[model samples]
Target: MQKKIVKMFDEIAPSYDIVNRIVSFGSDKLWRKIAIKKSLKHLPKNPKILDVACGSGDMIEEWKKYTDNIIGLDPSQKMLEVARKRFPEIKFYQGLAQNLPFDDKSFDVISISFGIRNVVEIQKAIEEFARVLKKEGILLILEFTKPEKKSTIRNCIDFYSNKILPKIGGIISGNKEAYEYLPNSIQKFYTLNELCEKLNKKFEVIEAKNFKLSPASMIIAKKI
Candidate 1:
């Protein structure tokens, strides 16, 4: 599953950012800004950061506003190629979230935006996050979660994500199947509460915020 997802991302690498802007109406940037802002509150100035599953280095781009001591890890070479071209100074590694190629307590902050659900061994990945982060370090996650309940607004969101998003995203990205997997993955992913519970096992979950009219959510945690 992980290998297939990596290949899918690689195939969509060229149009990933463009399709995201169109589908999310550019709100993805706002969400990343919000997550980064919240993370800074608990982190020191110029903290060393690691962005896992850092597709196209979007979160790392946000992190660069504060510090340059950042590393990005992703499984898709094509995506990293785009990221490298965008930020030539930063080092990027091709690695899986479940197995990071780094020493223990190596980073002060670790972030994964919209990529946690892609990990097949999610708990192992969470453990790897804890292992690589220093004590009291920050963990920032921006993810799409399954809805807790049904509502009129949620139903509308479901329609857009499951039906409309694939068509528009497929048209723009030229990979309808990849866009289709987005909604299906969200449906099978953990809810906000469930994800926080998992984080709580290794970190103190400080905040979990849900965006209006969207399935995406952000989590800020501190390693315990």
Candidate 2:
């Protein structure tokens, strides 16, 4: 199943970025900008940052605006190929999050955006993040959350997310299952508190926030 996930991403690599922009109505771009600014407050100068599951490397590029000491890791070679083309000078490793290729205490900051949900062994990945990070190093996560059930607006967001998004994304990406899997994944994913609770096992939560009318979640934590 994990290898299938990687294959799906590889098949969609050409349209990944643009389909995201279209499907999210361009909100994803704005969300990343906000996430970067918010996460920056806790980062140190020249922090060795690693973006795990760094699809197409856009997030790494955004981080570069702050510091050049950044590298990206993704399981899909085609995705990494696009990323490498985008930032030729930056190093990218093809690897899994549960088994990172870095040494202990090697980085000051680590990030994974919208990609952690697909990880096969999420807890192991989080532990690896902790092991590779310097003591008190920052771990930033931006992921899709399952929405609450009580509001009319939230219901509408759910409809768009589960119904409309897959249709449009599938058409654009030429891979229906890939986009369909997204909504299903989001639905099955942890809630804000649930994920934060898991994260707290490895690190101290610094802050947690949500994007309006969407399941977008961000957590900034530090190694304990």
Of the candidates shown, which would achieve the greatest lDDT relative to the real structure? 1
Q: List TM-score per model, in order.
A: 0.98, 0.97
| Model 2 poorest 10 in a row by lDDT | 146-155
Residue lDDT tens for model 1, 128-214 = 999999999999999999888888999999999999999998998889999999999999999999999988889999999889989
Deviation in angstroms for 169 in model 1?
A: 1.1
Off by over 4 Å in 1: none
Cα lDDT tens digits, model 2, 1-224, are 89999999999999998998888888877788888888778878778999999999878878988888998999999999999999999999999999999999999999999999999789999999999999899998999987655588878888988789889988988888898899889888888778889887889999988888788989899999
Worst 10 residues of 1 by lDDT: 58-67
Candidate 2: residue pairs that collide: none
Backbone clash total, candidate 1:
0
